[model samples]
Target chain A: MGEDFAFWLAYLTNGKHLAFYASFRFTILAAVFGALLALVFGLLGAMARNSRFAPLRWLGTIYIMMVRGIPDVLFFLFFPLAFEQSVEWALSLSVCSAEARAGSAWPPCPAANLFFSTTEYLILACVSLGIIFGAFTANVIHGAMRAVPRGQLEAGRAYGMSEFQVLTRIHVRQMWIYALPGLSNVWLLLIKATSLLSLLQINDIVWWAGQLGSPNFLPQAGLVHGDWRWAYYTVLFVFYIFVTLGSEQVFRRLTAWARRGMPLEA
Target chain B: MGLLEAIWTDIQLLAFPALFNIYFAASSLPIGFGLAVLLALGKNSRNPVVSRLSSAYIYAFRGSPLFIQFFMFYSIMLALNPIWWRPMGIAWFAMSPLFIGPLALVMNTTAYTAEIFYGALRTVPKGELEAARAFGMSRLQVFRTVTWPNMIRVAWPAYTNEVTFLFHATALVYFTLPVIGNQKDIMNKATELFERDFNVFLHFSVAGLYFLVITMAIFFVFGLVYARMMRHMPKERQPHRPRLRFGPKYIR
Candidate 1:
């Protein structure tokens, strides 16, 4: 048992395993940035959805509808490629010389090309994830807003509070109680969605796990294993469960805090 | 090429693979639903061991990412044949990607669907069960006549969401498992074209449009069923309100 433990320690701490560490780091960072961006998008979407103007409501509705109507994996695959091409196209049009533009290829210029580094891809993944998840958040917040009692807003107005004041002081404050459950659900979903970063060629946990666990016959990598991918995937599965359970506990506490001083139903 | 001509070509290329996507979802949904019912029943069993086992199965499957589950299953199947089957006389252990892909999807969807059904089972009113008991119905009779139908009815809306997500998840199969000759799905075809012609977004857009149409069809069909099953409830109790939210509802 002692020897086995030592062997695993050496295997895991090998220089090659640095990718594993980087994968976990990037996964966490992506989730954090994605959640923050989603919050911003969600707030804006919710406000637009609730706006008095028809055009703003339409704009928000269209965004939510289009994002939600398709599979998220499709968006993850399409958005980065599409965004890169658009950037390259715009750059080629403006920056490339007339002679460079005479090429028959689509971009028509090599020098004006815009290649996305890993960081840019990560940012694009976060943005796409944010846009997809933000629609759900907007719906949750919108539903929670509607669930808030009309009398509370009336009470605020009775105190000579302005419309914006009533919205900020009463509606926004109380909506958290109702929205906590859905937002927590979205948080879990977003965490899982971060795994799609691997599809985008980002070196996330899934990518690293696939790389490390693939069958290797060469002697250079130390402790060559024959397709231990199942073992690696099992480790990933446990890690995700840990995250899920931990988040559940945290959300439970937040729900309790939100429920304080409120009625039982609320 | 012009944008219109390119998009048309992309759509033609994707048409074949889109059928496989449909096949994945179609074959899995019924099997997953049946397993979900069994799991829901097991979860509410009187025996502590059975109930705990069922809950653990649901929790483990639902908590993890489906992508990892696919990888695990693929690797396990690949390893199992050479390690366990070759020693034995069984020659059928060489599992194809075609077999393992749907197996993973069905298992994953079963977990989520079981949770939805379990939630609906818990909400089965106590008064109805007691009334059925007073009428001299056996436990089996109570379940078949009173409990099961009501559970399905209560769970239909959320189950619709599960079906939608499951259908969407079919797109992930080609990504996780190997795509043998002519076995590619819509997303696989789209990515192939995207890689072939790096600058064109038309291929991906065509694939996305196909998925959008499929999603709408799912919503329409499920909405009709929901309306029919839920017609017994009062109008106010029915979910007439539009569900604008677009995330996977399985986590709830």
Candidate 2:
């Protein structure tokens, strides 16, 4: 029993396994940065949707509608690929000869071909996540803006505040309380999506788990283990559940703090 | 090739693959709907064990990514193949993506749908329930007469949104599951086409068009049902009823 315990201890702490452990940063970074971008995009989207200008409102409608019917995975995959190719295409115009450009080939020539390292891909994945989830966040924020009491805005106006001042000081300030619940839900969805980062070639936790848990065979360590991916994935399943539990607790507290000094709704 | 012809060919190619997605959603929805109702009822039950179990099931499934759930369940089935499914001569039937795809989707959607139903369950009119109970109605009868209709009415709009999300999630099935030959879905086929021509724009847009059309179809049908359910109301006041609008409701 002691030997078995030692074997597992040594095995889990091996170099490849350490890399696996470190790869979790990719997931964490994607979730944090992706969510920040989503909030920014969402604020922009909501502001546009709420704008008086017809053209600005149309842009927001298009942005939000882009995600409405399509699966997040489709957008998640397409946006990065399309963006990479677009950049490469632009480069090809400047770098490639006319003959190379005439060829029906991607990048038009070798010079235009560019590779994205893990970090670059990670950044792309974050932006893709932002663009996809931002629509949901926009809906939540827009609704929250409307939920801000009209009287509060009126009082700000009565006190000689400009429209921008009333918006920033009164409407936006009070909107957080109403938006917190929906925003919390969006945050949960964004974190869950971080699991797909490996699909973009980012070496996230899910990728590492699959790699570490596959059957290992070698000249010296013959048949080290059979398939253990289920165990690895089970850990991930539990990890996410814990994250959700923690988020729920944190959001509950935030809601209580936000509700302070406000009269209770029946 | 003419641009329209190229699109036509691409759409025609994906036409069969699109059915695979429809199959995943169609096979899962009714079963998921039935299971969700039971789960929601279980969560609301007086029995502590039942409530705890159902609520935990909902939480676990809803909390995690469906992408991981697919891998998790598939890996478990793979591990089981040598010991159990093979021994029983059922490995082929048990491990097929066709079977497993809907199975995971049903599990995932049940949790989301149950939460919606449970929320609606709480909002059932207390007076109506009490009136039924005070009239000496049986427990089952009170639920049948007073609880079910009101819950469905209240839940219809959100339920419509859940159904659309579930349909959208069918895109993830092929990513985790092994596709046997030409059994690819829309996403799979689009990626394949993309590799051939590297036309990221055309293939994916066509794929997105298919999802958009089907989603609209779902909204239209559900709206009809919602409208029918609200027919007893006076017309003017009934606009507030939960009709499945074409635009965004809550989405995942």
Candidate 3:
């Protein structure tokens, strides 16, 4: 029995399975970067919604509404193409020689034509995910900010703190307690959203799993496995469950810590 | 073709796929809702084994990507040969993506909607159930008359969102599964046009607009239902409670 286990382990850890590592690495990197970008977008969105100016508030509202109303997968497909083309178009005007630009109907210049490498696609995936999820985080943070007691802000003001001081000190600190649950939820979504990276043709884990599990009829590929996609997908299934459940536990602990010494008002 | 004519041709090509998208969503929601009620009941059962099993089922489905789930379901179904099994020796399992696509969507939606139902069940007022029992209602009667209606009422708002999200999810089917005999969803058709014409922005934009319009229609219909169903509640109670924010929880 132990020998059988060893054989399978050795097989999976071999050179052919090296692509799995790439998928795993990119998935984690995308999630981390996406989360950080989402934080920035969410903070800005919330502030804009709360702004005194009508146009700024309107911009934030429209951004959130459009994102929330649209299906995320559409954005997943649309953003990269739009972004890539826009970049290429800008480069065509500025970077391409006039001779190179003369023939093509669209851009008319090979110099302006940008073929996105896998790494660039991965970056775009992260940015797309960040932008899509940012709307959701903005909604959560806005609610959390509202949930912070008005009395607490007034108390800060009574203590002779300026508006900025009160916001930086009390509002931001207390908002975490309210926001942790929602933020954690977003984190899980962001992680799952990383799965869509494969759809962008980034060769992420899902793509690798599909390719590696496909039936290898050609004997020269060195592996003679039949279609084992189910097995590969099962591995991904368990990996995701473990990651999400682990995040859930961590968030629970964080929430508990945040709520410590506070009045139980929920 | 001129730009207007080209766009018109793309739209004509996408019409059938758009119909399939509606068919996929419409078929899954009710079936998933029924399965979800049973799963929710199982999760809320007194037996630890049943409850734990249901919880594990929910966790497994909710934790993984729906895209992966669709692929996994297709692979597993394709791998299984029902003809090899005796007694019920039918080849129904080996059917085309048309059949399997909805199966995947149903299973995934059931897991998500079950959690939503289970969460609502948790909040069913104990006093009402007690009152039903005190009035000589049987266990089934109490559940049917008091618990079920109240659970549905509480879950309606979230369920509306779930239905909309499930509609959005129909787009992923063709990406994961092989669309047999030109059977494709709107997204698939849009992708085909984009590849054929290299008009990335126009074709995809039209597809996106279709989805946005469908989602708005869903919201509008559900809003009417919400108004009628929730009319008896107090003004404060009628306001939709914000469930868990974003992510899997949003659908749940």
Candidate 4:
């Protein structure tokens, strides 16, 4: 027990491992934010796809159709960079205006100092995740919206409800029951994908795990432990399994509650 | 014209690696599919041993993430034969981006495809198996003629989607391997282009477009194959057939 405590202390206090532990926050943050953003984007996309307007429907359909076809990794790299550059450009524009007006080397005032720092960079990363997963969420939500029977909407209309009322009261409420299962799948996938945020230098768990496992610092003098990334990764695997199981249980319970009166399969 | 030539050369250079990746993915499908189908069969098997082993394989593969599996394989190889690199002139299969890419994908894809095949196999009507047995058909013959063909017919659509997903997932290869000098993949090249040229927007977009084009091509070809297969099917078992809608319909 003492040996185990020492081993864990040595493991946790390592600076790189500390970064890795911190990275879990990013992972959890990204997962929650991405799910929420994707939910919003997905809802809007689904609404647009099912809209009366032709172009909006086409736009929504195309987004759903195209994104699933393209790889998530591609979007991971592309969207983040695109968002970063856009933010930088906006900053550059502000800076240039300040320099021109004040005749100083320093840039002028902006919305917040945070935007100039890593805070905005991380925000951009979050936005990228949202964009990447939004298409998946849209697919889930669109299917869910469709699952809300057309007759339900007509029934609402028969009760003298407006289109907006029918959508808000009947369609939206019922869509959750159908969407929950797929949305849960999307959430699970998003969690796995949070690991990829390390590639963007967000210092996520995978990155830190690699850092702590490197033999560069530790000289415990046993087997040298050169490339034991596997062990750390194994821990991550177990972590993910636990997370997925917990979330799945929660989602399953939610689904059961949502389907109180419906058929078992439904 | 020079720019056009460079682009052409780039495409030409990418052709072999792309083919290699595609070959690796395509070949693994059969092996993985075979393993998965066997497991699926085992899952439904009357024998306890077969059932238990397959159920275990399915759970282990499905429950874990793929990236960790790749790393685990690499570590295990190195630990087993540290000097294997000296003789073979290859350090580790995991470090070899080529091997890691395919290994991870095959393992992951196999797990997925197995479930798909298993589902389809289970849905095969019991009456058909009974009829085959009644006709003095051996177990192998029953499987070959009655079960296998119907499984393929039922599982083809889901199988097509899996193939597309596998092709897309191949991008993960870039992160796993030690990409030597210029032998990088489209994703690798895109990453390098971003760092070197700072043309993140242009380069990534180019890579994304490349992936989009390849995915479309695969989809079209598969569509053709699907159409051909459908044409060969009995008229009654065409797209409008109710059995075409196999698996859960949670997603409308």
**lDDT tens digits by residue: candidate 2, A1-266:** 99999999999999999998899899899999999999989898899998999999999887776687888999999999999999999999999999999988887999998898999989999999899878888988999999988888999999999999998989989999999988898989988889999889888888888898898898897999999999999999999999889988999999999999998981
Best by TM-score: 2
Task: Identify the CAPRI category of the predicted complex in candidate 2.
Answer: medium
The CA lDDT at B105 in model 2 is 93
lDDT of 4 by residue, B1-252 (tens): 365674565565455556655765676677777777777788889899988887766655666656556656655565545656647766644356666566666677777887788889988999999999999999999999899988987887787777777777677766765677766667777676566645565566556666677767776777777777678768776674221111221110
Instruction: List, residue by residue over B1-252, the lDDT tens digit for candidate 1.
Output: 687887787778888899999999998999999999999999999999999999999988898888888888887877787777677746253477667877998889888999999999999999999999999999899999999989988788788778778878888898998877888999888887777657446777788789888878888888888788778889887876224345456732
Candidate 1 docking DockQ: 0.60
Worst window of 10 by summed lDDT in candidate 3 chain A: A101-110
Against the reference, the lDDT scores of all candidates come to: 0.84, 0.90, 0.83, 0.70
Error of 1 at A202 (Å): 1.4
Please tell me which predicted candidate would have the highest lDDT against the true structure: 2
| CA displacement after TM-score superposition, residue A111 of candidate 2 (Å) | 0.9
Instruction: List TM-score per model, in order.
Output: 0.93, 0.96, 0.92, 0.85
DockQ scores for all the models shown?
Answer: 0.60, 0.60, 0.54, 0.36
Fnat of model 2, as a fraction: 0.65
lDDT of 3 by residue, B49-160 (tens): 9999999998888888888888788778756743342335555544467677789888999999999999999999999998999999999999899999999988988887
Question: Model 4: clashing residue pairs?
Answer: none
User: Ranking under lDDT, best-scoring first?
Assistant: 2, 1, 3, 4
Give the proportion of true interface contacts each model preserves, from 0 to 1: 0.65, 0.65, 0.61, 0.45
lDDT of 1 by residue, A146-177 (tens): 99999999999999999999999999998888
